[model samples]
Target: MFRISVLARRYSTKPITSYFKLFPQNFPHGGPPQDSFIINPKHLRREYRNLQSENHPDLNGSAILNSEVVSNEASLSEVINKAYTTLKNPYSRIVHFIKVNHPLHLDLSRDEISKDLIKKFQSKSTQSSLAYKEILMNVLEVHERLELATSEQELEELEVENEERIEETEAEIADMIKYEIKDWDELMMTAIRLKYWINIRNGIKEWEPGKPMNLTH
Candidate 1:
């Protein structure tokens, strides 16, 4: 199970500045889009409860229970389910925000990723599932490089090497909202690098030899 509070904290540490760029508060000429109205979790939950009370098939009297009413209730229930699912998951929420607010027009240059690299990543897998293991291995390799980095200047330089690619990927995401792109693979690679560097930097800050208490403040 995923922890929403943990994700919210992570995002707070690295807030999405680009979100405001993509979804501005107001335009110069007109009002915001209909979908731009933010759905409050409390309000949604209340609405759902109210809907259930009204649509409960058990609630029977002289009221003519039409088939159309039942169908509409089902549809509303489906919408409620979808809304809850999207709101609960951070990744899904992000994707939904992009889809609703800023549709992209992406054009991919590469047709296929390197098969040899894919094979190498696959071979490194100890079990039948290769994906998680491959990501972890990539992160480990980057962390090793970061450990060898001597100074803050070296770390900054390493970060600069990735900055351009990260920016390009962000732009690509903005443009190609609907289409698949080879750029996503590049973004994942860069994310792994960033994650490793972050871990290594934290390790250096809390460096210690033998004692368990060395990591304490």
Candidate 2:
């Protein structure tokens, strides 16, 4: 069986700088990079312990004379903390995976939202944003269709279709994000679609009468 304690100790003993090098791109915004090495909970806990041990000032005693040791240790600990945070949560893990591996060329532009649609979304009442409401309706329609799916083959087909829709929607959102589009009308529409599919996917996992909820739930 894998052990988190061993992994943590191993990582912590390495020079603090080494951790940053392990995931340099992930820390573009700040201090130290997260521990991307963890692939499972066991690995996660091990890394956590290693970081705590190495950073504890008392461990070094009088052996190290540099004042920077404290700061470095603090930074290392923070990285471990962020890693745990990302790995522990399913949604965060998905987002992190997208950030790390998805193609950067994915467009983020306002062009995906036509002017007529924007007007419709903006003109609606506040009960729920018009765009979001529509997206939810779409999701519901798809889900109902999925429920009526006749066979394993039919269900598989629907799953493929839904997956395609999600991919297309995500690409549209990427375009919007890339261009820094500030149009609430456009952003909300894309966000609504994204959230709708996410919920639908989660819902499918629990559709069976007595099955336990999936990790996302």
lDDT of 2 by residue, 127-214 (tens): 4466456655676677776566555676567677766776677666555544333553455455445555666666554555343333
Q: Which ten residues in a row have the lowest lDDT in candidate 2?
A: 101-110
Candidate 2 wrongly placed segments (more than 4 Å): 1-23, 26-134, 209-217
Query: lDDT of all predictions, in order shown?
Result: 0.38, 0.46
Instruction: Give the alpha carbon lDDT tens digit for every residue of 74-135 in model 1.
Output: 65456445555654332333344433332231111111222322343356546523664665
What would the TM-scores of all predictions be? Answer: 0.29, 0.42
Please give the distance, in angstroms, between residue 58's alpha carbon in candidate 2 and its true position after superposition.
Answer: 22
Distance from true location, Cα of 149 in model 2, Å: 3.2
Provide the lDDT at 175 for model 1. 43
What does the lDDT read for residue 141 in candidate 1?
Answer: 58
